[model samples]
Target: MNKEARLSRLTRMALGRESSDYLSRDVDELTMVEELKNKYGLENVYRFDVGKNIDGFSPLIQDVLETPELLGLITGSLTEYPENSYQRLRRQLSLHHDIPPEWFVFGAGLESVIDHIARAVLDPGDHVLIPVPNFDVFQSVSFRMGASLTFMEMPGLCWDGNILESLCRKMKEKTYRLVWLSNPVNPTGQFIPQDDIHRLLSHASETRTLVVVDEAYGEYTDRPHAVRSASSLLKSYPNLMVLRTFSKVHCLPSARVGYMAASSERLRQATNTYRPMFPFSWFSLYMAQLAVLDGDYVNEIRRRNQERKKCFFNRIRQQDSGLETFMFLESDTNTLMFRHRDLGADALHGLLAERGFLTANLNRLTGIQNQGFLRMTLHGDAVNEKFLDACRWCGRHLFR
Candidate 1:
């Protein structure tokens, strides 16, 4: 058969989605980080575009790097590695969350775990409801499974206030295969209030819809008065699945370690069947185990982030009084989503880069209509000053 005739119907269907230049463009933006150095001098640009890069190399990473004989440890880990390292990690998490070890499934990242769940639960043309603007992964996985998608649109800066009620009503009327949501939501940095989350979960439970919650930003929101993560409710809502990562909270994105928490009878069992015999690299697994053991480092980062969060916002507001800047204080995470009327998100992104500051351009991520909202990460003092100075520079020079 000719090459064209050799492909399955599924392949042809997927290819049709991929064949769009717009789809390819979105894929390119998601995967690649464009270098934005000096237009002429080619100087380094401080990236603020990624709202989630670690403020600094984590102490756990530092320990691995600083150890002169770390190679000896890495090479010899297999010799004395625990026979049940995953079980041990699960035990640690189980103790932390008061959950059974069997309820959790580990993966390379929350994203990979999400894919596994989609594979296990979805059938062709199943309905998937994702609240926008949200992490693109949910949309991608839904489409990959030949599931239909209906987005409940929210402004890029924050969630629509009626989302919970609207979602519950929708769930009652339709049998959705899955629902995806993020805490301290991506790009926007808005978090759903805890009470609303409970109501939504109750509705999903009654309807038997699979609800996946990405809590990658859980660590940052682990503040004294912040909204708590949905993990605490896992025991009550078997229908709920929480996706968390060391990537965002523990600052171990490169290690790509993440896990899923679900009830023993549902996602936990199905996802286990989908789990590979060899899920990820041994080195990553080793590092993840160590990260869990080092709770001190995670705590310190969170504490410092809280203090830095205030200073970062204050610095931005103190800039030129002439330019009106709107700051969204609704987020309880490390990222701050904001915008200025003088520059739309895309144009502002380029201008900030010109001054050696990188910011997450929300126009593309949040949908074309919300071209004004942009998000920035809270970083260490040095990086914060660079970003703050860039903002000051923009107010003085880039005003429309």
Candidate 2:
């Protein structure tokens, strides 16, 4: 009478492979936070765990959603049942990125895209090279697919010449079917430079390794100076695949839309081998299309995000609170990871949670070891001020 016992042996093994430390505390604590907020009617609870583009739907998106005609489309007969709305989306995205339409493939989200790619390419014992302290999905999916994984520890939370040399040396020494790199890495918020990526891709091309560059936070690096996307290198390096999501800068995570870019040949191989039928709903497709066309809105969001991040960083640097903090430099993403001098990440997380603030505790994430860092997303000025005040209160009253 055990439901879990009925699972296929493969499924059981996959479940067993799940990391006890990766995404365990933060995800579970987030669920608990939501329940308490709803049950106790707590309006002031702040969640810095999830990296949503903004607090809620953007003004333009909300306006589009409220349109009666637009809402009616949700109930109308399906226009493209077999192919769904992917044709339209592919065109828009292609025009946006200046790539051929055949170069794009859609998924419910980046996580879904990652799963699809893993399922298509990974075979039992296939090697996958991933840097440590990354988004846990990379590790989880590759492992579940029964792929051999090699984790390269990124020293100081970012890659340098030594790390790059070591990574390339490993690539030359081993045949990796896939290499997963998260630009502006999750949990760390450090942006790997374009030159370093080029160096890796150059080696990957010779080794015939598929380099999947996850640009989930790549849009955030556009302002002040543009960070050229690895997608631009797709024409030159056919071994490269770039993944992007509308969840972050586009403010449409609820729509569950994400896509991958590669050479048309690579797309054709993946499509011919394994393709998800109608991966996006009509409502999701419609909103995602609108979000994509609203280029001005996206640009404004990026501008404001950069300014707000700068202000937040400077304020943290200048704060006279008893709590001392440390942060990584050159982070161009929505999230920031830092540590309290005197408290472990779990202890600080507990203090903040009690004060109605939820943060991602990095005490046990791979590559972080016992560093005691916690990751929090950048919010608006007012909300960030409240968080800073909470930290000061923890420092002055609790620690002192």
Who wins the lDDT comparison? 2
TM-score of each: 0.86, 0.90
lDDT of each: 0.72, 0.78
User: Which residue pairs in model 1 clash with each other?
Assistant: 48-358, 49-358, 49-359
What local lDDT score does residue 67 receive in model 1, on the 0 to 100 scale? 87
- Cα deviation at 215, candidate 2, in Å, is 0.4
How do the residues 237-328 of candidate 1 rate in per-residue lDDT, one tens digit apiece?
98889888878766667777789988847667788677775666667766777777766666777788778877766665665533355444
Q: Highest TM-score: which candidate? A: 2
Clashes of each: 3, 0
Q: How much does candidate 2 score in TM-score?
A: 0.90
The candidate 2 region of ten consecutive residues with least summed lDDT is: 321-330
Off by over 4 Å in 1: 1-5, 18-35, 57-61, 77-85, 155-157, 223-227, 319-330, 366-370, 395-400
Question: How displaced is residue 40 in candidate 2, in Å?
Answer: 8.7
**C-alpha RMSD of each candidate structure in angstroms:** 3.8, 3.0
Q: After superposition, how far is residue 149 of candidate 2 from its true place, in Å?
A: 1.2
